[model samples]
Target: MVTSFLLAAAAALLNAQEPRPVEQDGHVRPNIILINTDDMGAADWSGGGSRFIQTPHLDQMAAEGVVLTDFYASANVCTPSRAALLTGRYAVRSGLARGVIYPHSDYGLPQSEITLPSILREAGYATQIVGKWHLGTVPDAHPLEHGFDEFFGVPYSNDMSPFPLISQREVIEEEADQTQLTARYTEAAIDFIARQAGREQPFFIYLAHTFPHIPLYASDAFLGQSQAGRYGDTILEIDWSLGQLRQTLADHGVAHSTLIIFTSDNGPWFEGEAGVRGRKGDTHDGAYRVPFVAHLEGLTPPGAVSRAMAMQIDLMPTLARLAGAAMPDDRPIDGRDITALLQGGQESPHEVLVFFDNDQIAAIRTQRWRLVLRTFYRNWLVPLEQFGAVHLFDLETHGDELFNVAEDYPDVVESLSARLETLRSELEGLPQRETPLNLPGDE
Candidate 1:
């Protein structure tokens, strides 16, 4: 009798109209903490990008987690790139076409756009942004206005310092000292984490460190820890913050449950940091490609390195998926969820990345072949922003050179020219591209 009833039940369930949901355990979700530094490079540390600078915190995280060998940042400028990250769509789809938020422009990230915080918060995570919210500096263009539960830091760029900055909904602190501001950001994050911990809720903290950007400053402890001088000393302070954060999580017994990420917004400031081409607005590999590392106690594998094509835009969907957030269905997203690789699920992922400096220049890279349009990496964000007019190069032989990527592969150049036109037409014509801007939104 029992066997007969069981057979009937199985049959009924199989014949049900809707397929069973892919059930993800939502019991104890992981907390997320993302760290984004300004204008840093891959080799600026001991791991992948640089051999000189000592980014111990970033390096340690790489050793204990996944290191993307070829992660691209999509756009070469700060504003467009950041917009791409928040929306998970190309920046061109929004009104921002180039470098960053205008001084007093009211245009910020369109409210209708979907951001990582919106998705995660919907999934029950307490999302807060603490540091360098460069999406906009307008009255309505704030992180809280987007989706963050709290926002405390510069609404514009760090170079815009020595002026009042925003704190959540208002400009509470203006022309705040760099050291004090950073400490406050860290303190805010720690407090946010503590509050979340007390409530036993998952929290998403975006600790945007404004250190080592420019007009560099440091507290007494890190005043002179490096032979590299003030810049190096600034990095030491950054490291100190990381150590403290890690310890804070551990002290609160949430270290094993918190995911701490360390990375930069872009390559090192070219003018500020020597031996690097293109700093703030160049399209060179150095400008758009920055260091990225993700580490968590239970989920991430330690000391892993991956050469897969990763980008800042991918973080949106990845974090949302990890947080079990409901994704928006209104618009198309260019980012992919590489949770498998991050969790040691796969050694490699299949995806290509598109990079654009500005409307005048662009580049695309597949697994091996790369197409460089007429643009060098050493342009933009300067007093006189000059587009390189037109130049192409083969990325294979000229990976180190900034200006000539097509000199060797004439075939690649021709292929890229045709390919680029097709891509541009397709991306531009997409209905998801709602707010067309004067520029191609850093293409």
Candidate 2:
């Protein structure tokens, strides 16, 4: 159970979504860094048993932090997954369901929504985001409008049109050198860290790396460095970026006081290893279950492994609580604060995790049971109940999802299906899903 203090804190968020004085919380305010990787696999790290990909820096962080084994992204794609991570609400609730937004799209997260950086910034933290801002590419929908003090990176995916690098909406490089992206993003992050080092204010850095996704590119320094080919080299470069971040923090004498979280936007793509059945863009097991690690020297126990079912949505409320920032309570928040689990709670905070492949409900996962309602094949939706059989897998016994036990666990399937129906009902009542801007060629 969550402590009374946390419960009260959560209650307080309903009134004012701003930072309160930290006297209620016992610990001093700590700097926070959220590193979100793109299309990286769950087992891509050396510590997680990567055969060819080398992620030594990530392995070292996991060795020194709590590794969350069952962490999941809210969705399987870029835009919606990022939306859930930033807003703590499902994309369906925000009307961002269906498909990814494009450069030509006029859509973005609603301005009424309060994002993670908005609360952190209100808490007297210098909030900045340095990497792919795939949520929206337009000027009005840029990170600056979404509460980030500074933004430096591409507006959309590296593969998107224009492909220009920007610094707070101003184009820095047209058609950014994709090969040197990892290194450049790292340099920008280091610069941000160095600026924040001597300041008295706590900092929140959202460093979203845009590599290991596809059309793989590597810097000259790491061009021929990995045995796993180009993908391996790209992962190594990202690892080096992590090392640089750690070194910068240490050099600035703020290593222990900073809480750094490393996770992926979703699962791996075709080239990267998923270690499970499906790859990116799918609603299957491996698609949304990405790697997650949290590091804070005295606060988080080193070398601890947590099997608690957590998600990217949880970060907003959890980080806000740690920073004494109040969350917005006007809307329904899908994320729950899992600080207790991070501190060594055995039980999971979540009763059920609903998986959204874009906007539609794809699956729901409980502690040991997973009910897959539908599957996507060749870009076509296949409703299991309509066409064939609803699939259920015992995650504990079948992590790879090799066996279907829906018939054996009829009661469990019924309960999960009922819950999924309830969730779907809520989504269905929303003011219709928004249409994304057409991709360049499609337009």
Across residues 207-319, which tens digit of lDDT does each residue of candidate 1 receive?
88776777788887777767667777777677768777887887776775677777777777644234334455655566777777788654566877766667888888777
How do all models score by TM-score?
0.82, 0.92
Off by over 4 Å in 1: 1-28, 49-52, 271-278, 344-351, 359-361, 376-398, 402-410, 428-443
Task: Give the Å error, residue 189, model 2.
Answer: 1.1
Q: Kindly report which residue stretches of model 2 are placed more than 4 angstroms away from their true locations once superposed.
A: 1-27, 271-274, 432-443
Residue-by-residue lDDT tens digits, candidate 2, 252-350: 777866789999998888833544778788868888988888887555667888887888999999998888888997889989998876765667878
RMSD from true fold, candidate 1: 8.6
- Clash count for each candidate, listed in order shown: 21, 0
The TM-score of predicted model 1 comes to 0.82
Q: Which residue window of length 10 is worst by lDDT in model 1?
A: 18-27
